[model samples]
Target: MANRSWLPYSISGEIVRGFGRGSNELGFPTANYPSSVVDALPDSFECGIYYGWAKVNEYPVYPMVLSLGYNPFYNNTKKTMEIHILHNFSNDLYGSHMTVVMIGFLREEKSFKSTEDLIDAIEQDIAIAKEMLQKAECLRLKESFSYDL
Candidate 1:
């Protein structure tokens, strides 16, 4: 299991451009923290899926599902912190400032046998995140998360 103490953590940074797979392949657009920000995380922090709330620029807080890992399924060579905000944006977010308050862990990162399986897992993760973030504790965190960025 990953170190839970490191979580319930908040981080703010610019969303940089990634490989463009999230939208082109998965149909879900994701925002990522720059490598400098991502590298600041503690070394023992294992990669996995997480649930929480996030704000993009001055936008309202939104439920989110995060995939922090090397993406074994995609054979990614570098680690990434990919956050999928559950909202449709009418504009590009390539350089937007985003903040996330992670409240809970969903599952360990795993490789799927096929793209269909991976998509299914992503859909499930979003559903679980939506439900979990609605809980009292998570709701409280969501309410407390600052939207200044």
Candidate 2:
């Protein structure tokens, strides 16, 4: 785990439209941040999969898996911060304000030979996030002032 100082990083931004593949293809719906938020990331910030806590608007906090990188599998030209909140929502939150408290890294982003492989990896990341977020420290952060959930 490099750049430990960046842990528990707090960021808030409006959820924007993404490629739509996250749910239509991968079966996971991700809330994406605007490019400005992505650009503001520290140069030293690690580009990888991370587990964190997220809240939309005034909703309760939920465990989440985030990818901060130019997803190699998709060959994206731009960098992105895609957050997949663990809970299912009945409607899209495209314009809602989302706040995330990143707590720990899972793995570096990687390309896959098939879309199935990428989905599998994402599922594994979600499982890891669910377990890690159960920790007392993570739970405390979920209720912290930064979240305002």
Candidate 3:
């Protein structure tokens, strides 16, 4: 594995509205960050899928999968930071303050030939994230200062 020089990278911002496809089409709801938050990423932070821990406002920490890239499948013009928290919530969290500590990279973002392929890849990413987040080191990231919970 490559050295995790970016491990424990932290960022916090209010969740913003996205393209509205994560839940409507992909069955995964994602919390998006504003352009200012995305612009603050380090130059070395690669465009890829990552697994991490996230906290929304004062809510409990949860495992999460993040997509940091200009989504090729949708031909997005601007780079985006989209996070899918691995827990069910009864209400939309838009505008809620969220903090995340990225623990590990999962895979590079790619364009899919079809929406089904994209969904399949996202599902696999979710599975990989769930398994990886159970590791001792990753679990310990939940205690990092990035998250208030």
Candidate 4:
């Protein structure tokens, strides 16, 4: 089982730099976060699809699709945390502090070809995640069955 406690706390940080050739599809302008900022996160963080709310210092945002993974299609290099803010989330978070509130995990990260394909897959993931999140029974099941690992 994967440990998720590492990400227990909501974090506020800046986008210092970002890399890779995959973020373009999500309309996520890629940039890297400083080592200090990234390292501040827990060491045992679990990687997966996540839905979250982000408050950008410069702009407003709605629910954002957060992804943590190594892009296998582009030769897995470094792991990344990329977010695709929903419409009305346009703002420069590059040098500003943004707070991300993780709501739920969608799925383990994986790479797919074709921008359209990726977007379609994300749409489905988000739909399932939203439905699951809204159901108290489902959340109970998740907690009751969830293991610390």
Q: Highest TM-score: give the candidate number.
A: 1
Q: For residues 1-149, could you state the per-residue lDDT of candidate 4 as single tens digits?
A: 46666443455677665664435546445434555655565667777777755556645444556776665555556766766665443444567666666666777776777776777877887677566555675454335323211
Clashes of each: 0, 0, 0, 4
Model 2: per-residue Cα lDDT at residue 119: 91
Question: Candidate 1 or 3, higher lDDT?
Answer: 3
Candidate 3 residues 77-105, lDDT tens each? 99999999999989989999998888888
lDDT of all predictions:
0.88, 0.90, 0.89, 0.60
Question: Could you give candidate 2's per-residue lDDT for residues 1-149 as a string of tens digits?
Answer: 44657887989999999999999999998999999999998887889999998889878888889999999999999999999999988888989999898999899999999999999999899888888888899888877844355
**Arrange candidates by lDDT, highest first: which order?**
2, 3, 1, 4
* Strongest candidate by lDDT: 2
CA lDDT, candidate 4, residue 135? 67
Which is better, 2 or 4, measured by TM-score? 2
Native-to-model Cα distance after best TM-score fit, residue 105 in candidate 4, in Å:
0.9
In Å, residue 128's CA in model 1 sits off its true spot by 0.7
| TM-score, every prediction | 0.95, 0.94, 0.92, 0.68
Give per-residue CA lDDT, model 1, range 1-149, as digits (tens). 45878889788899999999999989988999998988998887768999898998888999999999899998898989999999999999988889898888999888999988999999999998888877898877877785334
- Candidate number with the higher lDDT (2 or 4): 2
Q: Scored by Cα lDDT, where does model 4 land? A: 0.60
